[model samples]
Target chain A: MRDIFDQIRKRMQPPQWASWQTLIFLSIFSAATAALTSQAPPQIAERIISSLGWVFLILGTWWFVYEPDVKKKLKIYELFIGPWIVGALICIYLFGTWEGRAIPAPTAFVSWPPISAIVWSIPKFIQSDPKTKSPIYTTPTPANRQNIILVLLANLLISCWFQLYFEVQDWLAEYPSFRAQGFEQSAFVRELQPPEKRLELSRGVDYLDAAEKALKSQLEGKPWAEVERWLSNLDQEFPTVRDEAFAQLSRVAENQLWNLNARVISDAYDLEMRAIWQGPSARTAEYSLTKTCRISQARQVSTPEQLKFNSPTPPALSAQQIRSLGTVQCGAASSPDSLPQP
Target chain B: MFTDVLPLRAILFQLLFIVLAIAIESIVLQKYLGIGQKTSIQYAATANLASTVVGWLVFFTAESSLPPSWRVQLIGYIFYDRINSPALLIGLAFSIFIGTFLLKVQTINWLDQILGIRKPSTVEVQDPIKFRGRTAHRQTFSELPNRALGVLWANAASFSAITFLIAVRTILPPTNY
Candidate 1:
């Protein structure tokens, strides 16, 4: 274990070729892969790109820097990484513009320009070292510079294409509304009735409108007196026409009353109601009502023994009859006793 | 002293590096750029001449059968193939050339540093190897090819493998319902 540890320790120390150039190469590769995987739309693309970058970076570094015999070979590999990186960018641009649908202009602006500038400057930086008065400027020759410029122009075209694609997609997804006048004209042709017919149909609209307004106002948290008064006024206004209107109004009122009953039932079941009715008298009232129905049904049963036992029975009753009697009788008998003594 | 012609080991190492570099570059680009794996492989391969012609042939053959989107995707792959893969080959060649020159310089520097050899200002030691000799003299940096043909072949092989894989994936019948 100690020997293995020692070997590992020895390996950690970087060799001669482990300079700023190698570090920058690794960093750039890392950044590129991160950007690709992190920003790429499809999940599969992201994973593949990230894994490939990692595997290549490690292999390239190991081949060039670690293995003594392959040092020269590795250096050659490093040189290729730059151009290949440029190629990758071009591919990204082409795919995005042609196949990937649209290139997001903002993303291209954010990611590509800086990356291009950095990559373009690398050869120049490497060529000009302060220590060496004239370091060899190997890459960024006039020909390479021309290629870079071409790539940049291609990227710009692709970016514009992407923006246009997104705009089209947005247009396709938009909902047609009144503001979309052309869309409204085409889609809602049936909704646009003839103006004279529309006006004729709405001729008696003012009376109906007035009735609706009065009903709405009378219904707004007022006593039944105000509603009755409004109904009477409506009747006086058009005695012959008022019957049908009143019938319709009555149906609406019935629906509202049913809804109110439902709300009251719900409120009774609420915690607030339980707290309000927490007294012994309320509990007794509830119990008696439940019990009275059972007693009344027991009396109504036509068993010979029960009939013989209650020879003076008041009346025979069905289950529903017993329930109704229980409700009426229980309320009448219990209300006074159940009320607060004060 | 004349050495044996450039060692096979050196060539093999160079080829290995070329493959490794391209694979890494392709993977990185695919992972980050949201490009398809198939596209990345194609790009990695056709960046150089030996592979580009083959890639173009494959592309044109596939183009008629594929949808417009796929064709566009293929174009992207081809573009990357032309740029990154070939550039990598060129970079590798340059690095090899530079590394060799640096090694020679370092050797001379080491001798002077360790042996305390005083320079006789009168005479300069000329490089033993010269152009057009039995010994392979290193070419002046200017004379090296802009791109490496050997690296291109390596890329072509990788591209072929990738294209084959894509074809196999597409052609094979589904096993599951």
Candidate 2:
């Protein structure tokens, strides 16, 4: 490690200060890149110049944070942590920052921009000496190696933890019904969301919308006779409709966690589809959301004359008896203590 | 340098999951398959690694063969944590469960075949002329009672435990798992 750093240091000697030519080159690079990527000049110039200035400030602070240009034992953070901070700041400024998604989440505690600077300043306050001059040529000792290894391991562990957090986020995003469940009995996860604020972002309504759209597209604009015939074999036909509706669901995932089933509430009057969530929950009980759909004669009358043609081909089905969704209603989330669990 | 070449995060996660699965499956195999603790652990590790290796191989093969749109989705899901479609995720999850179970069964049988049978002696003779008459015997395979079913139960238990851990992690701090 010592030999590697030594070689790197010898090969990559940074100038003591930014020269005029280097500054001009950086400015032109930033300008060209910004102009190529952005349509708005002012905003582009502002963001690009601001980021460049901040990067400069970060590197500047890193160099001058030490007490004097003298022989002093520099800690690891003082020597190397600036790049990490600058990287974080660049990532945030370039890509974006996000609002916390989980309960009791720490947004930037582990990855804030100024953390390196703060950490680097600590040794400066404690170990600063006026007599010290700029000769940091300490040989790598066993204790030094041990210290470096410990810091590396600690950083690795923190990165692994962040990766785990990302993994959980993936699971939750892919399987969002898990978010609806209670976590009181869980051993690994604990929810800190207040009781009153729970279930505020329930995806029940969105799921119902999908189910409703599927119901109308599948059965709404058909003959009443065909509708009755389909309802007659609800056992077989209901499953097809359920699959279609569930397929249309963009809520979380398909055929997993959330269960969608439909039955004729009133064969000719309305159809009721129930979406039961079979996912991890914070609550002890499960909830089912329902949506009711009906055919409306009024909507078909408003259809353009293009519908009268039905198909460019000779169609066998009734084209004139077009039906549209009417009085569609989605019920609130209700725990099905009495209803059979899907 | 090493970190750039290898996915350190993924390795960390895989080792953790493998360890957890191995611990649980070992216990399950010991009680149900009637194996000694050490043998159970060895079998579980072998089976888990076999399934994991096969899974990664399948992933790479599919990634290379799939279309650009699908490749994007797979890459995004794996690297960016972007679940483009729930159907893909659910199907992948279901396939992994079934695939792991079947793979573990075959691997456990293979491991059992090796470990359960006593290997023929190495047949080392310091004096080749003195031991000229000696012959080495062939090795044999051993059969375990209810090996497939035992692996099934163990697989199911470990999968459930892992799913539960993932579920619980939704509300967890970034400390344990």
Candidate 3:
């Protein structure tokens, strides 16, 4: 064992091409640099070189693993020793992650080694000319079938890792309220930071605000006569208003995850809008944020024509005053306890 | 970013557990089976690594194939560190514990067979295995044929050590870290 260590030390070289260790270090360094540079703007050369370093790591490790052992490389010995080292490190992300479909651009940097290991199996199964980069016509070797199975299994794991990353991100984005909760009950995850330090995700409040504004714009500043007409025919008008509400929101809402309902109660003099969150949530019951846009008009009995007239100087009028054509005033969201009675 | 969200601590814990297992298993094998230090270490490391690799594979399969409702709990566990129910977590943990123990035991047997390693006769290596942690070291390497009983003892020791470690980590004030 001591002699083996000494032999490896003697074989170690400074340049990446001459030694696998140097190549591994270089690959790791380049991957770190790329990850750091990605946070800001990266230079074209830096990006290219960082990407190329991974390629070197892949090829270099493959060469070292297979080159010395073609004598008995296909046997169980090479299968365990060579790839296991690289695979152990690779397992960090693959095993720790919950799920993912495939390697995205950023993940592909450190992912090159296992991928190279997978690619190495190809030649073993079917002969290929390395220098010419041409496939030599040959059937997949039955003796090396395990190599094919191993590669397929590796890819399957990689897919789950990437998929899980995306899944977690999506889940958190939807249920921000769950972040503050304790993870003691969880075996897979835990809260590292306290509740105060974590980000405050506006839980459907922003959506409600958008919906209110949408309703106000649709109802406010209209001629009193037209306002009265539209209010009476809310069935015909509510669809467009609701559509506009959702249009102001994110495409991710897609009218399916979120639904905005707007209605004017003539008896109550309220243009109430409810933005119920139908998206993924920790709660069994969904959260519904309500914004009641008070429908008001000036105390003065202004004629329809007079109401349309522009006033150069606006008066400081509260709910007591009613001078404009009509006003749909919106304030903060109301509790989701119950819908207001019409 | 996804990189920022990576479970680096989990990976570190796993590596730490492997090292601890290898050490404990080597000690058990070296003392009980009358094997050389290097030989015992080799057997312990090989079985641990193989089991770990397979454990990850099983995790991926179960994760991807999870139903929609269970997937929600999985996401919650992965991201927010919360699970709505403890039943799933408990069941999953138990299964993994038993699965890994079996895998480790089988891997040792497989290595022994494939490598044509010679084991001492029942007369040379004879001792009873008391499941208790205190007497386990002294209790025995059983009269049964292969390295099965020895591997079981080793795996059990390693699992207890890892479980204690996990309990310690979980008990620590999360904010302090």
Q: After superposition, how far is residue B129 of candidate 3 from its true place, in Å?
A: 24
Worst 10 residues of 1 chain A by lDDT: A270-279
The parts of candidate 3 lying over 4 Å away from their true place are A1-111, A115-206, A217-342, B1-3, B113-116, B119-142
Top candidate on TM-score is 3
How far is A41's C-alpha from truth in model 3 (Å)?
Answer: 30
Query: For each candidate, what is the lDDT?
Result: 0.35, 0.55, 0.60
* Candidate 1, A5-84: lDDT as tens digits: 98986775445564534543564666586675656466676666555655555445434443455444435644433433
- What is the Cα-based lDDT of residue A262 in candidate 1? 7
Per-residue lDDT for A253 in model 2? 49
Ranking by TM-score: 3, 2, 1
Encode model 2's per-residue lDDT on A26-130: one tens digit a residue.
Answer: 545565665556556458665766577555544444444332532144346455544355445444544444553322223343343334334433333243334
Q: Which candidate is the best by DockQ?
A: 3
Q: TM-score for every candidate vs. truth?
A: 0.21, 0.41, 0.52
Candidate 3 vs. true structure, TM-score: 0.52
Cα RMSD, model 1: 30.1
Residue B74 alpha-carbon offset, candidate 2, angstroms: 19
Model 1 accuracy (lDDT, Cα): 0.35
Residue-level lDDT for B112 in candidate 3: 58
